[model samples]
Target: MRIAILGATSQIAKDLILSFAAHSQHDLVLYARRPEVVSQWMNNIGLVDRYLVADFTAFSPAEHFDALLNFVGVGNPAQAAEMGASIFDVTLKYDDMALGYLHQHPDCRYIFLSSGAAYGASFDEPVNETTQASIAINNLQPQDWYGVAKLHAECRHRALAPLPIVDLRVFNYFSHTQDMEARFLITDIVRAIRDKTALKTSSDYIVRDYLHPADFYQLVRVLLAAPATNTALDCYSLAPIDKATLLTVMQDKFGLLYEIQHSGVAVNATGRKPNYFSKNKYPKEFGYYPSFSSINGICNEIEKYFMQDNLY
Candidate 1:
């Protein structure tokens, strides 16, 4: 399988690239606005033939290449707000072009990295594919830029109906390569613990489910292999580990517990919050189960860290 990834710098992209590359049957082609911008990010994307420079900012399918996986998207609110004009052009217009390519190619399968915020946040319930979406921008306004942009993108992908699309409402996924300052609570907690003997968060850490990078890639690869899309089977949370468990794992792994603060109320996010996801269906369909969750991967990462220096 030859896979082409858009936004090669993305977390999902990095993981999927490595997964695709590791398989002798897969050949990956990476695309982004600038190769040099994320050359450091694509260290695992060694199998890619070249970094096809194309910007989602200007929805020009002619500018981008047709690949198996179109795993490029931005969910950062500040960034999306800044990219106001580009957001519409890329998410709506050009995104369709990419989908059309997938639809026509017969060989290409589109796997979009989306957010759970697309589920509409006001309703506090575990969401499944049955949940309805609120297409109103007003409903999504308070959800933050990242949520709004992602919902908009997901909506656009859905709108390009009559085409096969895989809109994965990915939850909190942490990777070793992302910027340390990003908003991921686990990464932030890890950073804080690394920064000082005592780890602290200004508020009781929000419970976010986590998915490991390896499992993420497997999920994507399996979905692509089967070419199931525009349906519940393709769209899913990467894999989940609830917040309490995540924090507990972190504390146990590092042996550092700190004065965690709390604002008292739930930290509301915009749109829907189906942050909880199950890999059961995906695993059943593809025979792949993620080897790690938040805690599962932490211990392994720690073990590998110590072993590198023969500390075992």
Candidate 2:
């Protein structure tokens, strides 16, 4: 299979490029905004045949691709600013290429990296592919701009479904490919622990599941190898998000302490477990139950990166 990957620079994207390039007998081509901005060895894990570069603002998919791993959405934080100017193109422009690429190569097996945001507000119950979308069309005015962008990307994938498209509304994923600049809580915690800083979290922590990079990659490989398998499980979580009360557990376990500011309101995220993701199919599909999820996998990265002298 000849594969083209857009936005091969994200932690998730970087991992996908490497994993696919390594295992599959496919000819791989990687693309990013700046040709060499991405680390040389990042996408070469599988030794892709080509590494093309182009700004998504000027994105145009190159021809002759058998499959596409479109993981191009950057969770820009500006969309929620009080006077935000909507620099959404820096993000939405990739949707242009993903849709166009699928249209151009009708036979291409396209995998659009959708998000758990598509579940919208139906989080009242366990979310499935059939759950009603929480947000209405174009009403993407959320503080978590990344979540909004993910919602938009999923919609685009839906528009191109007849073209062998596999849409995955993945939830929180943590791994080593993460950029130092990223503000994800797990990475932030790792950095704080490495540097020994106080972690200030909400009095009632937000409960979200986490997954290890390897497990996440395994799921991606299963989907890419079997693109026709529409088994769309709406969400993926490494740990049972139900126990997500506070990272104070993580903090205390790691010998770190912090302050918490609770909402002091009823029925809010004031130290409560939000939901749990159903994880049967993921195991059935990938043959690997995510053992090292958020509670463990995230800390694992810190252990690997920092525990050089038996610090754990």
Candidate 3:
């Protein structure tokens, strides 16, 4: 299959690209805002000759593709906040680009990288297929914009029911390719271990299910091969890990030092989500099942990072 990947420079997209190159015969054409960076990365990883790198501006409907995966969006909370209201425009732009392509090639499958934030601000419990999105239309906030943008795209996809589009709502994703400087709980833990500095974290208990790249790739592959349908699916692992357990594991295996503070930890731009993952097993019907549990996946990827950096 020939696949066109938008925003191919993203960590998730890069990981998936590597997976496809290493494990499959699919031809990939990577489209990114900064194609040079992706080209350099491909060269560094010895994949320079294996794929084509093109600018997103060069994305044309004239090119035929079996599938199109849209990974274009802000990666971190800081980026999400910085992008602000423009998230809507950026999302709509790329989504419309893909929709236009789908119009030309109706048989092509589109896999959109959505987020659990699309479920809206409150996440007191894990989401399921039955869970409806909760949005405060009268009281919109900056944090709501990102999720709203993704939700809007999903809405548009569903409205175009004849098209083969699948929205994968990822709650939490961590991998060896993740930026170390990024402000995420697992990254903080990794930094603490790497720098031998004590981690100071808030006492706000939260549960997260970090999807492994392998599992994510499997989900995408499953969706690509599944019967055509216009729907959304929540990404999940074998199980989720709570903050307490995560901290304990990091401390034990990685020699991470951490102190819990009652305050001063920065809040997420997308609002507080005490339970950010999903319990939805809908993807199982499409023959997708995670091979790693949250802790196992975290350990596996972190170990790979350590090995790569000679930190172990």
Candidate 4:
């Protein structure tokens, strides 16, 4: 399969490239805002021949690809806060560029890396494709811009795009390549385990799901091959993970220590309700189930950071 990946420097995009490159039959064309960085990374991986260094707006593929994955966006909350309304404009601009490209090549399957934020500020229950998204009418803040932008892009594509497209509303994802300095739950746990430090949290009553990086690409491959009909699928692993059990396992297996400063708080840090898991048809529709459970996935990541001598 021939594919073109936009925002190729993204962590997820890089993981997807490494995953796809393992299969000799899959050919890839990569584009990033920084082509030199992408070229260096791809060259290190020994698959630099299929890459082109160009910005999203200026990039025009020489030939049609079987699929195009758009992984572009301002993901950092701090950056989103700093960028303000420009976040929405930048996001929609890239979406429009990709959609226009898809318009010219109607046969190309389009996969967008949307966020669980598209569900809006509510997380009272497990979000499915059927869940209605909310908008903050009275309290629109800088942090809300990212989610709002994603919601708008999803709406725009579903209503207007002429080609086959699937917006994978991703929740939590963790891997070895994740920045250690990032204050994510998984990274915090990994770093604590590595340094033998105690991890304290306000509460562990909240529940969520985590996807293995490999499984993410697998879902994309399956959906890329499937008939895309303007659909939004909640991207999650099969296993539902809660904070208490996850910490328990880490403590038991790796002897990591954690303390819950408070309990009885069901609400997450987002101030909205928490979704234990997401409902999707990846298993039934695509026969795709993630091989790694939440614990197994974390252990795999831990092993990569601490135990494994050779980089994968």
Candidate 5:
């Protein structure tokens, strides 16, 4: 298959690119704002001259691609907050670009990298197929912009029902390629372990499902092979993990030291999510079942990270 990957520099996109190159015979054309960086990264990974790398500006409708995956958006909460209202523009711009190509090539399947944030701020429980998006339209916060942007894109895709597009609402994702300095709980734990310092965190009883790269790659492959459909699918693992369990596992496995502060840590830039995963089993219909649970996936990736850096 000829696949076009936008925002190819993203961590998830890079992981998928590696997986595709190593595991499949797909011809991948990478589109990024910084094409040189993508090329350099490919070189660093010993993937030199294996795929075509082009700038987003170079994307043309005339190009032939069986699948186009849009990973073009803010990668982290900090980036989302920093991007502000521009998040909507960034999402719309690339989505419109993809839509234009879809209009010309209806056979091409589009897989958008959406977020669990699209389900909105009320995640008291896991989201399911019946769950509706909740938004405070009258009182919009900076935290709400990213999710709203993604939801807006999904709405547009649904409206174009005839087009073959699928939005994957990813709740949590982690890999060895993740930015260690990023302000995520897992990244914080990684940093602490690497530096051999105590991690200060809030005692928020949050639940998350971290989808491993391998499972995510399998999901994408399944989607690409499935019949054309215009709908969204929630990404999930075999099981989700809670804050206490995650900390305990870290301590037991990696000698992690941590303290819970009564004052609590600052809220994430994308707002708080107590139950940030989904209960939707829709992906099973497409023959994609995760092989790793949240804790196990986290441990697997962290071990890879340590091995890569010789820190373990």
Candidate 6:
């Protein structure tokens, strides 16, 4: 299969590319503003010749692809917060470019890496594909920009694109590529354990579900094979982990020397916490089941850090 990826600089995109590279039969066309940046990663996979250093808006593919994966835009929440409202403009610009291409090449399958934010900061309940998104346009905020733009892109793709495309809404995902300094829960734990520093956190009552690389591999493979239809699926593990439980595991299993103190309030930075982890309906729909449970996935990442020095 011939696959093309936009935003090749993104760490997640690189992970996906590496996963695809495991299958030598699959050819990849990687696009980025700076091709030199992804050169090392491509070389690592022995696919250096498969990259194209070009802007997404200007570059049109010379060869047809069986699938096109759009991983563009500022995905980091901290970065999105800095971008503020312009996030919408930047997101739609690239999305429209891809949509226009789909109009020209309706046969190609398009897969967008969306986020749980696209569900509009729902704290009320666990969101699934069937859940209705809740975005408050009148009371827009910087935090909401990323989710709003993602939701907008999903809507636009479904309504405007001539062909059916897949939008995978990622709730929480962790891998070796995860930025250690980032304020994510897993990274915080990793840092605390490594540094032997007392981990300071907000309330540990919040619930989060994480996606493993193995699960991601299965998901992409299933999506590539399944006939496209305008649909969105949540990317989550079969198991959900609570913040407190994760901390407990770290303390007991890894001998983490950290003092866990809560601020006594559960402040929803993005929105209210989902009552439950997003449902894993992708398996039922596409026959792609996740391999790692929350504990196993976390342990695997930590083990990589300790043994291989591939610290996240």
Worst 10-residue lDDT window for candidate 3 reads 263-272
Across 1-312, the per-residue lDDT of candidate 1 in tens digits comes to: 555667776656766666555654655566677666566554444533443434444433343333445555564433544564555456555466576666556445676666665554543545554666555665435345555666776766666655567766765666555454554455556555556556545543234556667767767666666645564332333345556666666677666566666543223333334344433254445655566656666555545444554533
Better of 3 and 6 by lDDT: 3
Q: Write the per-residue lDDT of candidate 2 for residues 161-265, one digit (tens) a residue.
A: 466777666666766556534455565566566567775554543456676667777766666656363334443545554334436566667765555556532
Stretches of model 1 off by over 4 angstroms after superposition: 40-66, 75-89, 103-107, 135-145, 155-162, 202-206, 232-239, 264-283, 286-288, 301-312
lDDT of 5 at 43: 96
Q: Compose the digit string of candidate 5's lDDT tens values, residues 85-157.
A: 9998889999999999999999999999999999885888888989999999899998998999999999999
Task: Find the number of clashing residue pairs for candidate 4.
Answer: 0
**For candidate 4, lDDT tens digit of each residue in 1-312?**
778888888888888887887754677778788878888987876876855556555667456778888998754444455677887777887788788788888888888888888777567778775778877779886656777888888888788556688888878787787676665666777767777788766673667788888888788777766665677777777676887888888888888888677754222323344664677554347656777776677778777767554421
For all predictions, the C-alpha RMSD in Å is 4.6, 4.9, 0.8, 3.2, 0.8, 2.7
Clashing pairs in 3: none
Q: Model 3 over residues 158-183: C-alpha lDDT tens digits?
A: 99999999999999999998898888
The segments of candidate 4 whose C-alpha lies over 4 angstroms from its true place after superposition are: 46-53, 75-82, 262-273, 309-312
Q: What's the residue-level lDDT of 111 in candidate 5?
A: 98
Task: Kindly report which residue pairs in candidate 2 clash with one another.
Answer: 21-46, 22-46, 120-134, 121-134, 204-270, 204-271
Clashes of each: 10, 6, 0, 0, 0, 1
What TM-score goes with each of the models? 0.74, 0.76, 0.98, 0.88, 0.99, 0.90
At residue 7, give the lDDT of candidate 5. 96
Which ranges of candidate 3 are over 4 A from the true structure?
Answer: none
